[model samples]
Target chain A: MLKLQGIRAGYGRIEVLHGIECTVGDGEIVTVVGANGAGKSTLLKTVSGILGIWSGTIELGSTAIHKKSVERIASLGVVQIPEGRQLFGPLTVEENLELGGYAKRRSGRKAHAKLEEVYELFPRLRERRRQQAGTLSGGEQQMLAIGRALMAEPRVLLLDEPSMGLAPLIVKEIFTILGELNQRGLGMLLVEQDARLALSLAHRGLVLERGTVVLEDTGQALLNNPDVQAIYFGQHGGRRDSRTESA
Target chain B: MTFEQLLQYVASGLTNGSIYALTALGFTLIYNATDIINFAQGEFVMLGGLSAVSLHEAGAPLPVAFAGAVLTVTVVGILFELLAIRPLLRSGVLTQIIVTVGASLAFRTGALMIWGRDARPLPSFSGETPVRLLGATFNRQTIWVFGLTLVIVVALQLFYRRTLTGKAVRACSINPMAARLMGVSYSRVVLLSFAVSAAISAAGGVMITPASFMSYASGSLIGLKGFAAAILGGLGNPLGAVIGGLLLGIIEALSVGLLPGGSSGYKDGVAFLILVLVLFARPQGLMGGRIVDKA
Candidate 1:
């Protein structure tokens, strides 16, 4: 489980995340949907200790990790699959995955075992294990990014825009994999721009607006909310105008 | 030129090439890890040679002297990182560059104070006998320089390809933030890079000093050549750096062998000319691709 209370963070003198509180429970997928520049990525960075928290507490199962080093936080099992699928472009897919298991590298066989599990999950990665990460297609790169995070054997996986730049069919495939992993009890905190897709996969959802949590409810509840539909799903319930009406 | 003469030039060129390659390798390692060109890289070689000479003069055995020189330079590298580099990391690339240039000046000044202005010679690792090959004779030290450089380069390649820490460092080079997300400590990798760079450069300094006498000021030209090699090979690629150094040396040697009278004096100029052409024609160098920082 992960919890953030009264979290405030920013870049330089410009504050972005202003007094936010959120939680993701064990084995649950909590989706946070927000418009561009809504401080979603900043929140994840703060939790992962990549950015310093201005105020508030972030905890994983009651142990405060807000002050920990980025590496220490990752070793404690909070790993992030950052935005844009930041795989090492020059390195092979296997090498990128090996780096993901860096924290556990000294554990010897355990690390290798985890690597095997990752290979099993993404068989395409095994086939192109020697291929440079940059050469992979967008969907495959996303898979490698997620697979790299899984190599860490994370307790809570923080994903930022896993569906961004991915085709609709690939997005469906990735979400299906996420669902399957969730059934295996892997906790995920997903920040997504595709509100419909994210909400459909999540058990609970929160709507963020202007660095603040504007709404929180069950995924179905938020999906059915008129205001949510109006903003996220687009005009007229995201349906095309009828021919007679247009005429 | 006769075949023997050509072989002689190549053999001599390879000796100098190995030294430049070693120093360039240092540049590549530190640059890859921290994205900072450590101008003090040549100073590590100077420090290594000077320390070994000082130790040898102090009556320590040759092997012991060599180890002391490497260890001393390694400490200097770490201290440089702690005292000079670490503080400037957040101050942007320009600041880091200025600080490294300043650090090299300080290192040179310190070496002057310690070793003074006179160029000093190091005894060859083996007997002073010239080994005869194909009607050409070369110093035994040439074999040592070439052999040792080959061993170090191969070992370094293995380190980058086979070791987890090495892969993590490569990951850092490619994407520091993504490496951090994977629990790889960026600072630690940078520190290790500095240490290894210093050690390799120091070894070069020690090995090359026997052939070319070393003074406190010797590092400036050597460092420049090494920097040129790194740039020629594509800055961050280690294998490229080695090949670049060798190519630069062979070209310089060939110019001396084939060019008209007094052209040897223009050897350094030729190296820089190549560097200028590389910057103009292909700034990425031979092996360098455009590195996209996705993180």
Candidate 2:
């Protein structure tokens, strides 16, 4: 399980996440939905140790990891697939995946076995193994990003806007893979801009508003709530549209 | 030019080219990892030659002196990163470049203080037996320098392609954040790059010192030439640096050979001329891949 308690973090003096609290249990999918600048990306970055937490307790199981280095945090099984699919563009698909498994390189056979597992999850990547990562389509890059994270064999995966810029069909395929991975006992904290799609795939959902968690509930309940529908589902179309347009 | 004259020029050019290639390779390693153009790279070469000569004078075997020189310079490289470069990493590119320039001066001054101003002569690895090839004569040391360079280049290519740690270094070079997220230590990679860069440059120094006498003042000119080769080959590509070095050497040699009115004095100018031409025509270099802007 992964947990955050009263987490306060930001970039330099500008506080972006103000006392945010969240948790994702084993085999669960918890989604965060917010408009731009609601600290969605900031939250994930803090959790992953890329951004420092000003005050809070972050735990993976019984161990606190808030003060750990990024690589150490990753070695402890909390891996992040960042907002941009940060693939090494000039490297081949295989080389990217190989780097993803770098921490486990000493485990020779086990690492090789994990490589096979990743290839199995995204067979298209196997076929395009020799191609440079930059040449891949947007959807394929996202797949490679997720596959790269999976190579680390994370106990808890933190995903930031995995569906961004991807087509509807491709997004659905990606979410399905997330569901499959979750079913196999990996926990996920998914941050998404597409509220409806996130709610549909998540077991629970949190709505963040300007650096704070405004609402948290089961995904179905959040979907059914009149306030959520009004604020996030575009029922208040004029206000929501204007906000998105400005963003 | 006569064919024999051409062969002689080519052989000398290759020997000089291999030295530049080695120094440029050092530049490429550090540039790829930290994006810093280490001006002290040529100092590593100078130190290598002088230190080995001092050790040899102290009655150490040739291999021991060579190994000691490489090891000492490698330590200097790592310490340089820890003391000088790492602190200014977040201070942006201009500061980093200035710091390296300062470091180059410091290294040169230190070498002068320790080794004095006189040029030191090193005995060639094998006795200087000139071998005749295509009616042109070349020394055994030329063969050693070229052969060693070929070996190092091939070894480096294989290491990057076939080894996991080498791939991790490449990964850090390409995308440091992603590499960090994948449990690769960024500092370790940067440190390794420095060590490798210094060691390679030191090897170059050891190889070339016999042909060209070693002196504390030699680093500045050689370092600048190496930097030119790096830029000419596209800064981040190792193989490109090698090709650029060879090309620069050949161009300089040809200029000296063909130009009228005893143009040998203008040999050094020829390198910068090629550099200017390369910058104007194809700044990305002869073998440089497309430059990708990091996010």
Candidate 3:
């Protein structure tokens, strides 16, 4: 389980998330849904220790991990699949996975088993273990990013916009796999701009408006809430397809 | 010049090229990790050779003196890394450049005060013996330079490829945040780079002291040649440094033998030619990266 209390985070000189109060129950898929600049990504980034928190406390179980280095936070079993599928482009597919398990490997753990686990999840990654990661398709890169995080054997996986810029079918497949992961007892905090997919896949969901959490509910309830639909979907529904709300 | 004479000139250039390669290793390694060219690099070489000569003359055995020389210069490199480089890492690239350039100036001035403005050479550890290979006579010293540079490059290649720490360094070079997330201490890797790079440069100085005498101001051109070799090989590629060094050497040697009065005055121009021409064609270098990136 992960908890954040009054978490204020930002980039240099510009505050992104004013103050966030969020929680993820054990083995639950908790989704943070919002607009493009709703600070959803910033929340995950602050938790992952990439962006510094100005006034807040983040806890991984009982450990106060707000001040821990990014690697230390990761070793505590919190792995992040960074936004934009930031795989090491020049490295081979296998190397990207190996780097993901870097901290675990240093303490004399077996990387091969983890590597096998990753390959099991994505057979394409195994097929192109020798190929450069940069050469992979965008959807494949997203799978690679997820597979890379899985290589760490994380207790809590934080995925940011895994469906970003992907085809409809590929996004569905990725979301389906994520549902399977949640069903298999892996806890996740998924941050997505797509409310429909994120809400359905997660057990509970939090709606972020601007930098604040506007609402929190069970996935089914949020799916039916008109307030959730009006603000998040109010503008896009008029221009883009309203069917995206059901995606 | 006769074809045979031209070949001999290239042969001499090869010897000089090895030394340049070693010096450039210092520049390339530091640049790879921190992206700052440590102008003080040449001082490490000067200190190593001069220290060996001074220690030898003061009654130490040659091997012991060489060891002390290497250690002394390595410590100096580490000190510079700690005092001059580390504090300014987050302080902008231009500031870091100016700081390192100043450190090199300070070190050279300090050396001038200690050793005076005199060129000194250490007795070759392997003796003045020469061996004939393929009709070209080579001193035992030239063979040491060639063989030693080869050995160091091979050893470093293995260290980077097979060892955990070296891979960590490579990872850091590629992505510092990811490397840190993997628990690689950024400071430790940067220090190690300076240590290894300066040690190689120091060894280079000692190796060539038998043929090319050492002076405080001599480090400037030596550093330039090394930079050229590193650039030609690829700014950050270790194997490139070796290839670049040898190429620069052969070119310089050929120039001297081919031109009338070229050997005496044309050596420096040969290295410049390679540097200018290589940069003109492939500025990213043979390895395809710049010495500096857009800040």
Candidate 4:
């Protein structure tokens, strides 16, 4: 399990996360939902070691990871798919995936095998293997981002706003892929703006407000919670919208 | 100018251009990795030539002296990175550039203190025989310069395209945060770039020192020429740097040959003239695009 205790982190002189505590267990999906500036992304950055915690302990299984560098944290199996799908723009899709596989320091044969698996998961990437990553569509870029992270063979994946800017149909496809990966024993800690969809797919969900966790419950119970429905699911519980959008 | 004279000038221009291209490439390598124009790049060349001269004077064979010089300069380049750049990694780009300028000054002064003010000579790898080609007579060292530049360019292309480590360096240049997330140590890339860049420039120095004598103060002028070439080609593009160097060298040589009355004195001015015109006319250079691509 990846566990955090009293995590406090922020940009210099401005605290974004205040005493946040969370846990992502083996083979589980934990989704965090919040409005903008609620420290959702900050939480993930701290865990991935992209942002240092002011005071807290980040432990992956029995290993203390707070002092580890970003590369070290990633090599220890906590990989992050950063916001905006930060692909190397001028590089080909295959090159981007190949670089991701470099994190593990495995043999060329193993990296090739991993490349094949990534291509299997995202068939479009295989078709566009030689194409520059910057030319891909928003949804395709998101898939490539996830595919890149998977190349690392992470024990726990931290995703930030994977559904942002993507069409509903594409989001559904991506979430389905995420569910399949979770089913195959990959642990995910997801941050999403779409609360209903994230809660539905997640095993457990948390409601964050301004850097603090306001609520934590099982996915089913969070979906049923009146407060969660009122704020996150809208006044009508989004019944008039698509099923994925509504609670 | 007579055709043969023009040809001779072209030959000499090409030799100088090769050296400038190598120095510009060193500039490009560091610029791509850290966005700093390493002002000390030409100092590596100077160090290489002088080191080889001293080692050869100490009774080492020409090839061994050349190798030792390159190795020594490579170590200096790495030390420069570890001592000068690593501490300022978190600082602003402008500050880092200023540090490189300071480093260039320090390197020049240090060279003066060590090697004194006299211009020194290094024996050519092969005996100094004049080779004639297409009505142009040139020293044998010119061929070595051309051959080494071609080899380095090809080797660099293969490294960037075919090797995983080279791709990792490219990845870091594109997006350092993403590279870090992917387990690439950013500092290592910086160190590697400095080492490779220094070694390349040192090779250029070793090749060209026999053609023209080297002094402690020679680095500043060559450094300016290299910087001019880099700007002319487009600052971040490696191939462009090579082309720019050759073009600048030829233009400068042609000016010396064609202009009337003591125009040789104005040869250095020609490089800056092109630099000014290029900066005003097309700052992105001939091969440079809207997007900056680094090797």
lDDT scores in order: 0.89, 0.88, 0.82, 0.89
Better of 3 and 4 by DockQ: 4
TM-score of each: 0.95, 0.96, 0.91, 0.95
> What's the TM-score, to 2 decimals, of chain B in model 3?
0.95
Predictions' DockQ, in order: 0.84, 0.84, 0.41, 0.82
DockQ for model 2? Answer: 0.84
**Candidate 4 residue-wise lDDT at B129:** 79
Between which residue pairs do clashes occur in model 4? none
Docking category of candidate 1: high
| Model 2 misplacement above 4 A | A235-247, B289-295
Interface RMSD of 4: 0.6
lDDT of 2 at B58: 94
DockQ-derived CAPRI band for the predicted complex in model 2: high
For candidate 1, the per-residue lDDT at B55 reads 98
lDDT of candidate 1 over A1-247, digit per residue (tens) = 7999999999989989988999999998998887777788888899899999999999999899999999999999999999999999989998998988888775578777887899899999999999999999999999999999988889999999998787889989999999999999999999987888898889999888889999999999999988888777754212122222335
What are the per-residue Cα lDDT tens digits for candidate 3 across B20-92? 8888877888887888877777778888888888888999998888888899999998988898888888887
Consecutive 10-residue window with the lowest summed lDDT within model 4 chain A: A236-245
Name the better of 2 and 3 by DockQ: 2
Q: Which residues of candidate 1, in runs, are more than 4 Å off?
A: A106-108, A235-247, B289-295
Residue B217 error for model 4, in Å? 0.6
Task: Report the C-alpha lDDT of model 2 over B1-295, residue by residue, as the tens digit.
Answer: 9998888888888888998999999999998998888888899989888988999999988889989998989999999999998898799866887898999999999999999999998899889889887788998899999999999999999988889899989999888998999999999999999999999899899888998989999987788888889888888998899998888877778888988875689999988887888889988888874373532
